[model samples]
Target: MKENILVIGGTGKTGRKVAHKLSKNGHLVRVGSRSGSPAFDWHKPEYWSLALQGMDKVYITFQPDLAVPGALNAIEALTKQAKNANIKKIVLLSGKGEREAELCEQVIIHSGIDYTIIRASWFNQNFSESFFLEPILEGFVALPQADIKVPYVDTEDISDVAVEALLNDKHNSKIYQLTGSRSLTFKEVINEISETTGRDIAFTPIAISAYTNMMKQQEVPDDFIWLVEYLFTEVLGNPNNSEITNDIEHVLGRKPKDISEYIKETAATGIWNS
Candidate 1:
């Protein structure tokens, strides 16, 4: 059956991909962004009903990290609005090792609405599409938690699972943990990118405190800096986060994209060199 789906954070990493696939599958997709029709904004609760109105399902990716302050309240409020709008199912993109993100998941679980929780490891796109890209372009990368091995999942795989969950009832009330087939450290990631791009990129391991201090010196936002520190200390520091999971394969019936494939594809885009 064709469905009307609202994709919150629709232009974001996984959200845009999910929306595209849904549209290709012949679903009515209303992208939820500040600039999108009905104009969905996380900070604006009054406008949520406009976004949710007449949507059969919603794919939600919280702006910033769900670990940030007031996220739980915002999620709770959104769930309430979803219920009011008669939204049937919601697929939430959540962090795998984040305790606070888990709390936000609970709100959806008890919302009396059908839901699928995608608990994902760190994303492979961080090195290419996010903050790490700038440093890689500059030929130097410095970060905390360099010793931790992260089984970074690709956003494409994430979107695939999300689309499946949204379109099928079998995934209702399911919680899937998504990770790559293998784990890699910061140095390993940098090495692969450097090799793939044929660029001489350097990696430096620094203390978490020192790293946050550097962000402060750069005048990065305090809340963002706080969330980064929390992720380094809380999420990456947890050893269980490194365990490779077959959740993506289980859901999509194929192995998740390996980091090498991501590196190679990204290198071809000339993003790192640019």
Candidate 2:
């Protein structure tokens, strides 16, 4: 049955992909952005009621990381509103190893609504659509840590799982720990990009202070810097995160896209052309 679905961060990377797939599948999709019809803004409580109106299901993608201050409160308030609006199902896009994100998950779980939690590792799109894009274009990627290995899941896979959970009842009330089929260090990823694009890409491992200083020099926003530091120090530092998962195959009935494939496809987009 086709249902009206609200994608909270519909303009964002994964959310946009999910919305596209759902729309293509013939479901009613209302993008919930500040500029959208019945505009929705997480920081603006007054904007939510109109967005949630007549929506039976919602895909919640919290902006600026749920680890930030006031995220839990915002999520709680949104879930409450979703419940009162008679929204029957919710799918949350969450981060791995984020305590505050888990708190938000708790709110959804106890909201008496069918909820599916997609706790994902770092996104491969970080290299394509985020901070790493500039470095890749320049052929030199510099970062704070060298020893950590991240199981970076592709946003395409994330969107697939999210679409399944939202449009089907089979995935209700489950936490999907999604990751890439393999773990890759920063150097490994850079080397893969170099091979795929036939360019000399280099990974420079620098001190945390140096990385922070470089970001400040580049005029990176304070919130983005905080999120970067949190990911590097706290999330990446955890050894348990380096393992792969079968959740992608379990959900989509196929192996998740490999990093090389991601690199090749993204490289063809000419982002790394120099």
Residue-level lDDT of model 1, residues 147-197, one tens digit each, is: 889999999999999999999999999999999999999999999999988
Per lDDT, the best of the predicted structures is: 1
Query: lDDT (0-100) at residue 254 of candidate 1?
Result: 100
Candidate 2 TM-score to native: 0.97
Model 1 C-alpha RMSD vs. true structure (Å) is 0.6
What overall lDDT goes with each candidate model?
0.95, 0.90
Which segments of model 2 are wrong by more than 4 Å?
none
What's model 1's overall lDDT? 0.95
The 10-residue segment of model 1 with minimum total lDDT is 127-136
Candidate 1 stretches greater than 4 Å from native: none
| Candidate 2 total steric clashes | 0
